[model samples]
Target: KLDMRRTLSEAINIQVPYNFERVMYLLSGGQNQTEAMLKMEQTQVITLSKDLHAKLQDWVSTYRVEDSEMLGTVQNLWGCHKYLSDPHTAVGVNAAQKFLHGTQRPCGAVICLATAHACKFEDAIRKALGSKFWDGTVLNDPKLMPPTAGSLQKLPEISRGTFREGEDWTQRLREVIEGRYPEATLVTPHLGTLWFSNQAMAMLLGITTAVCFAAILSKFARRSKR
Candidate 1:
């Protein structure tokens, strides 16, 4: 449950109320994310933190979410409705409502996609509500169990093969370079932060890979002469 994010909470929340009669045993840690992923489900995760927010760009279509506006919307909703909306959902709904108001569009109803459980971002919610969140209906609700503390203590286990920030990404390249051109040097470029420009680095990596192969062939020729 400790590793649980808001998106997963949204899915489970829907599953529970939609089928409350049956016992929905929620799996956590590696069991659900790792094991379930092994089944070949076409899962796509969109995280704004990574600047891979291109996923939501398609969802919003025309609307662009800015820094102050998005958080401002989230906080506004929290203080007003006592509803806790995660950053993703907050940006989305806030954009939609603003657009509709600006256009003066008259419609029967406009549906905004709220993707996460509020309990998942309890701290963020508290901040949004100005640390006066205990008065809110969401975290104070008696019917629901806390997301992190359900019937059991949360596990600190991160999924295997998960990408850690500072790991040696060039380890495999280093191995090849060491075996072939022991004299040659390679520099690992520090990608400052995750953004679309990372794609340009990807193309650069492809070119470096070709250089690696050339070095490997050079080593092979020298060995054959001996």
Candidate 2:
């Protein structure tokens, strides 16, 4: 069960082929959720450092990584970082420490946050991480919540149009078929004659459809004579 929350933004979508967990974090103390929501939206594939990967490997070897409790903690990084106290960096914290086995330095941390729409996920962030300090917390206010029916319907269609425009299957198929038939070579009488002779030879050997008719005719003639 993967929960995908879409934010409404006008940024270019970067679609990648990978599977991972999505951690939805609500930032408290009135911090702008647009940045947090954008961070969530920008996520496609998270690359782990070699050290991080090795640490994960070590943990997997020692503990059963498939344990349900372990998997849940691994999946919700952003949430875990928020609830847990951090002694360093203040603003940025690594939430994957429990599952990860390595000495911690916040090096090689290049985090990018993007969205299809920064505005859409505003409400979700406020609910999860309260907004009392971030510009008077529009989260609980009815005005801040998006109208359910209108924006949801419009987004999918817009996304589909952009996807189709970028890479069209029909056009690619057409090109493939056209390339194969470039010369427009025809099967002339010579080719037809060769095919016909081969078919005739097959028929004589009783390997064609005529064999069934011949057997039926021979049986009928014998019955008539009898």
Each model's TM-score? Answer: 0.35, 0.19
Reference-based lDDT, each prediction: 0.48, 0.33
The top-ranked prediction according to TM-score is 1
Task: Record all residue pairs in model 2 with backbone atoms less than 3 Å apart, i.e. clashing.
Answer: 8-117, 8-118, 9-116, 9-117, 9-118, 26-129, 30-133, 30-134
Tell me the spans in candidate 2 whose CA falls farther than 4 Å from its real position. 1-102, 106-109, 115-118, 129-226
Least accurate 10 contiguous residues by lDDT in model 1:
21-30
Candidate 2 lDDT tens digits, 50-104 = 7546655543322222223322432243255422111111112223342245454
Kindly provide the TM-score of model 2 when superposed on the true structure, using C-alpha atoms: 0.19
Model number with the top lDDT: 1
Per-residue error for 198 in candidate 2, Å, reads: 57
Error of 2 at 37 (Å): 29
